[model samples]
Target chain A: MITTSIESVPGRKIVEQYGIVQGSTVRAKNVGVDCVAGCQNTFGGELKGYSQLLEESRAEALDRMIQQAEQKGANAVINVRFGTSTITQGASEILAYGTAVLVQ
Target chain B: MENLIGLIFTVGLIVVAYFVGKTIENRHFEALKAREREFLDLPSLTTQHSYDEEGIQDCRLVYGNVVISGDYFKMVLAALLKFFGGRIVGYESLIDRARREAILRMQAEARQFGADAVINTRFEMSKLDAMTQNQGTGMFEILVYGTAIKVNHG
Candidate 1:
């Protein structure tokens, strides 16, 4: 599959337009990571615990997106972007989106 | 003497607990980093194309919702002991890690399709309300989508 951030793929051409293929995910934080993160203020440093939590979440979410594109038989995804919003004071969401297409 | 002994014991316990927790957290972080490295290391190339040339490809990728939940009661207690602070710091790092992982996965997928570049990528996040209310359990959905193009920069 050929994926890019731009609208068009260079060198090769997009033979078929596969409409709009997308992947989305909603991840919630566990209580343990939150509690450790809450205390990070006093200790000050890297919250390795929460860092790992987010990493896992992001991976899982992207995996779903890729699966969706694959289902459509897309050769690539392009124009990938990410957005994050705080659902609450202690919680937030990260989304990744892009275009799925087949190029030759 | 009794007061001194009690204080010493309490301090010792706290110290031991802190070390143990740190060790566990470090291990988890290491594992995550390894996974991230593997994803990013995948062979992939990036390219850009113009709309006039190929028209609107309109490609999208939707990932299954992955929910990861954990409780940091000890950390919360520690934060409470010191006062409600450092939440932002924790959040910043957490978000950063999450974004990186999402990007890596997208890149890997792009590579699989032989795409040199990805364009117009976007991300979305939401909270899992049904899961937890008080502890702030939320879901972060990363949707990395864009136009996969093969461009000739020559």
Candidate 2:
């Protein structure tokens, strides 16, 4: 299914609206990655480990959102938005949500 | 005698950290300035729609993120600022770097699709390395994302 953060798809027409579809996931890295991130923090630069973790969680959350849209028989999702919240010391939640629609 | 040595070591580390961290932050700023000039041509907006002459051919989601942490000196300075109740100048650069880098990366991704503009641009700030909000000064990630759209010239 096509997805865009903008309310309307560029060249497509929305024929039906399926309300809102959402997906969320909690993710964490291993202890080793955490330790490495701590060391990198001392130097104050990019944290590669955490970047990868965020990428993974973001993709997963989007994927689940797409699944929800598909279940609702939507061909696309629009106005998609993402949010992240730290759950604890070693885990965080990534949430993706959007309005599912049938597009032509 | 032992207390004097401890103080010396802390001071020495802070001094070294000041020099090294400033240099790194300066370099990042320079790089971001160069990129900002390039991105000016690629229109990016926070509104959900683009106001350009609308012959949009394609639209897709695009996102970029950058994670940065504090050096020894910044952490120490922030600790002092916590008591003083003022802005932490050291961390000011860190956030600036993360934000600029994130936007640039997002622009790079949009370019891959030959998109000339991005609309409904939104930013999300979060933590990295699985750190909770209560944790001490730790790594934070800045994410810039939007709907990348390619317009047809015809």
lDDT tens digits, residues A1-104, model 2?
88898778777778999999999999876787778876666667787887888888888999999999999999999989899887877788889999999998
Task: Show where candidate 1 strays beyond 4 Å.
Answer: A88-91, B1-154
Q: What is the DockQ of each candidate?
A: 0.13, 0.61
On residues B34-107, what C-alpha lDDT tens digit does candidate 2 reach at each position?
Answer: 98899897877998644553588888899998878888888888888899798887888788888889989889
RMSD of each: 8.9, 2.2
Query: Per-residue lDDT tens digits of candidate 1, residues B7-124?
Result: 8886765666556545654664676688766655332223233333544333433221222222243444546755755554434444454555556666666666565445555555
Least accurate 10 contiguous residues by lDDT in model 1 chain A: A38-47
Chain B of candidate 2 vs. true chain B, TM: 0.88
